[model samples]
Target: MSIVAFDLSRRLVAEALGTAILVATVVGSGIMADRLSEDAAVSLLGNTLPTGAILVVLITILGPISGAHFNPAVTLVFALRRDIEVNAALAYIAAQVAGGIAGTFLAHAMFDLPILQLSATARTGTGQWIAEAVAAFGLVFAILAGLRFRPDATPWLVGLYITAAYWFTASTSFANPAVAIARAFSNTFAGIRPVDLPGFIAAELFGALLAVAFAGWLLAEPKPPTTFKAAE
Candidate 1:
């Protein structure tokens, strides 16, 4: 269905539900990976694969409903581009953050882990911060570039990018403010400490802004040249 076919409430629900599922996949897969694998590399691959696959499915399913923006950084970028209204963008961000938290709790329930616990995982450093920025920048850039050039390929592009980022980035590419906040609530393998939230969030926002600026310039429509009659 097209975006115009869905109302605001439906769109909000789609956003919340999509984000919830996405976070559940990320956290749940991480937990399962850690349990099943003795090798850190294997565990990371397990976590990365399912998260990327689920992202492709979720985006394909929910994109038309809410633009499939499971990240607040994404919502902000769209708002900055005037693609979505400010009030609606605020609503979307709220839905995404709340859904992300709820998703963590759901994963905990499924795994019989504590539902409410702060992460002790200390993910902080200059390198980590830069990685997060780089991750976020690449994520937004891939999205904007895909949407502009080949909207049909966006899901696959995003999935592939995240899968690669999970390996390449020091921070494993949280790349999303809402996901980072939700991750802080979990003590699982994918968790990030609450203390490190500010740095990650700041870097992510800056990265998204940079993507907007860069994409705006790179993707701008060409203007028609003014014609001058030759001494008519």
Candidate 2:
């Protein structure tokens, strides 16, 4: 089906649903992992796998509809690039944020945990800030490069990159502002305190923008190979 097959409302629904599922996978798996394993490493691995696997599935299925951008930082990049209109980007961000929060609540309900809770898990300091920046940078960079060189493999590229980022980044790769905000509502393994939201969000946005700028240059077609004439 053509991308235009869906209307704006339908596309919005797709975006919301995709983001919800992604968040649910992240939040729910984190909760389950934490409960099932006493080893923090084992729990983190469990959480990491589901999050990465779900991203590949979600993006492949939902991408044709809404480009499968479940993160506000991503939407911001597209908006800056004029790939998506400002108004639509705003709407997408709204849907993403709303859907993310709902996903957190859904996970809570599924786990029979308290519905209302705020994360007290502090994720702060310059290290975390830099880590967040690096995480977002890598995430956006992967998407940009994958789209440029291999659109068909973009989903896997993103999934694999994020999986690596989860282990490599100090902040556990909360590269998405929406995901971070949603995670804040659940004080489980994936949670980040609301107070830390600003720094992470800022770092993520900054990193995303940097990726766009760098990709613009990096992905450019090499200028036609030209050779200077030898002097007589």
Candidate 3:
């Protein structure tokens, strides 16, 4: 169906469900990885692979329905670009956050863990903040650039970028505000402390704004002639 044909309710459902599944995969994989491996590196590899793969799958499947943002940072960027209405962006953010919470609970249920708990994983400090900023910048830049020049490849590009960022960045590229918030509820390998969220969220927003600014300049259309003659 065309975008216009899908009503707001349908789009909101799609966003919520997609974000829920994405977060579930992230949290679930982290739990499973931790259980299955003693080596920290190996557990991280397991978590990274599944999270990236699920992102590719989810974006490819849900993109046509809801644009498959699944992240408040992404939704905010689109709202700033006027690609979506402000109210719709707010609704989307709400759905994403709620879905993320549900996903964490679902993962906990599947893993037979506590359904509600605060993470004590302290992922803060200047190095971590800088890493988050850099990670968010690269993620948004790749997305905007891919959409401009290679729209069909955007899902894969994003997945690959996140997979790489998981290894390269200190924060493991939590680049999403919704995901960061939800992760705070779980005290697992993938969790971030609730207190550490502001820095990561701020870094993410700053990076997204930078990407938007850069994309506007890089993708602007050529100017038309200013000295046009009057028609006869």
- What is the C-alpha local distance difference test score of candidate 3? 0.89
Lowest-sum lDDT 10-residue window in model 1: 1-10
Q: Against the true structure, what is each candidate's TM-score?
A: 0.96, 0.95, 0.94
Q: How would you encode candidate 1's per-residue C-alpha lDDT over 1-232 as one tens digit per residue?
A: 1244678899999989988999999999999999999899999999999999999999999998889989999999998888888999999999999999999999999999989989999999999999999999999999999988899999999999999999999999999999999999999899999999999999999888998899999988888999998995
Better of 2 and 3 by lDDT: 2
Q: Candidate 1 or 2, higher lDDT? A: 1
Candidate 1 residue spans exceeding 4 A from truth: 1-3, 225-227
Which model, 2 or 3, shows the larger TM-score?
Answer: 2
- Model 2 over residues 91-144: C-alpha lDDT tens digits? 989999999999999999999999878999999999999999999988998998
The pairs that clash in candidate 3 are: none
Full candidate order by TM-score, most accurate first = 1, 2, 3
Local accuracy of candidate 3 as per-residue lDDT tens digits, 1-232: 1133568898999889988998999999999999999999999999999999988998888888888889888888788878888999899999999999999999999999999989999999998988888888888888888888898898999899999999999889989999999999999988999999999999998888888888889887779879978999
**Candidate 2 colliding pairs, count:** 0
How does residue 169 of candidate 3 score in lDDT? 94
Best by TM-score: 1
Q: After superposition, how far is residue 50 of candidate 2 from its true place, in Å?
A: 0.2
